[model samples]
Target chain A: MNWLMVVLGALAGAPLRYLTDRAVQVRHTTVFPWGTFGVNVTACALLGFLTGATTAATVPPALQHLVGPGLCATLSTYSTYSFETLRLAEAGAKFFAAANALVSVLAGLGAAYLAGALATALLG
Target chain B: MTREHPEDDAPAPGPEPKPTGWAAEPADPDTAIDPWPPKPGRPSRTPAREQAAILSVIALGGALGACARYGATLIWPTDPTAFPWTTFWTNVSGCAAMGVLMVLITERFTVHPLVRPFLGTGVLGGFTTFSTATIDTQRLLDGGRLATALLYVSATLAAALAAVWAAAALTRRAVV
Candidate 1:
């Protein structure tokens, strides 16, 4: 079952990653990968909500499995984020690279926290 | 330091004769050197067997990586209100591993092409997670540790990026 969940998550994550990357490329027309940042942040929030929901008295394990492992895993991507940052630095755009790094990390955490709180409040 | 070419210092001789192909003239000892070897061309289609092998490896590696990530969360237990150490360490360590692996695979090992899908894409992909990182940051803010959450997120992103760059740079240097 766990294996199944991982596979399903990956299937969802990979395509979403491709599409997000394409969208970012088309919109930004720059080297920076905004799509990855967007997805990672969103994924983080979803994960937080999943975690919060699981701990709550009303939520069930099945729900957590479907959403946490299946959805969040696919939604967030570390590899793309890492690759883009390096590309920026190599291109000598140190400031942009630094900003991308800072924004994703801080925003991701904030998003996750908010999601968790919202989920907890609503579900609890 | 000034460097001089020895050939340039030597006296010039008569004009060199133009080289001819094998069919045009007899093979000459001077023209025997082949600078570029003829490389075998790739097939028009990839073999099905190879594709299956790659997929299996990726799946197996992904499973292991995911399990390891899950284990990390369990090992580092923290309250929802406080900073989450498990997710932080998992991402950092995963990035570090990727850095080292990139070097090891490209430089040191004669890794099979399929190995990349399995280890690089599947295993490492599963090992490091962005979702957890994002959610953790949010949790920190919600829990009232706004500053810590912000700092943690920034540090993770910067460090992870640096790790890859450092790894690649080191590998290139080592190869050269």
Candidate 2:
């Protein structure tokens, strides 16, 4: 069941990632990788919500397997983040690279924090 | 293959396009690889038949990678209160492997086009997740494990970055 969910979630995630990246990158040509940033943070919020639901005992363990590791993990990526940051630094956009890394880390952490808190308050 | 200087014979016979870097989507809307070439430099390599195949490659690879991650979580299941070591190690290892894979594809080898979609965009993309890492930290912090949360967050970011850098550097030096 867990394996099936992972497959299903990732089937959706990989394409969504490509589409979102294309959509976000079309209008802008800067070094800041806004597409990846938005995708990562959005996935973080979703995963945080799932975690919170589990914490509140609202979501069963079996269901948690579907969205938490399944959707969220497949939806967001670390490898791309590392590469883009490296590319930016290599391209001499050191400031943008630094800012991208900082903002992504902070935004992801903050989004997850907020989602978890919100879920807890509403359900716990 | 002749080891001769045939550089002027119709654009050097383009090598099979491999995944150059992160997020090198084939169906990307903002493709700018060749602005002055008029029709761009990809339509021929991609053709019409290969485009659909690329999408399938991504889907299939994504499923494979996601299931692999799920298997890891099964082997190292973590409770709500415990550290999610499975995910941490997964991200770190995936980033490291990605570094090696990128260099191998872009520098050391000429791989098939499917290799990039299947491995780089699909498998590696699905294997290592930034979202789960943050949410795991949020879980720790919410449970009042401030120290653990801080350590986990910083350690993941630092280790992942270092892993990529180190692997890339080592691979480059070793190959060159």
Name the candidate that leads on DockQ: 2
Q: What is the DockQ of candidate 1?
A: 0.22
lDDT of 2 by residue, B16-95 (tens): 46554333422221232213123433332334566577667877877788888888887888886677788889988988
lDDT of 1 by residue, A1-124 (tens): 6556655665555445444544554443344567677777777877877777766656655556556755576556576567566656655668767777777777876776687779889888
Would you list the clashing residue pairs of candidate 2? none
Model 1 off-target regions past 4 Å? A1-29, A48-57, A106-124, B1-60, B104-111, B169-176
Which regions in candidate 2 have their CA more than 4 angstroms from the true location?
A60-62, A117-124, B1-50
Candidate 1 per-residue lDDT, tens place, B1-176, comes to 12447577767577546532221211111111112121235312336786456556655665567767765665777787776777777777777667666656545676667665566656776677888666666667667897887677778776777777677677657762
Cα error, residue B56 of model 1, in Å, equals 6.0
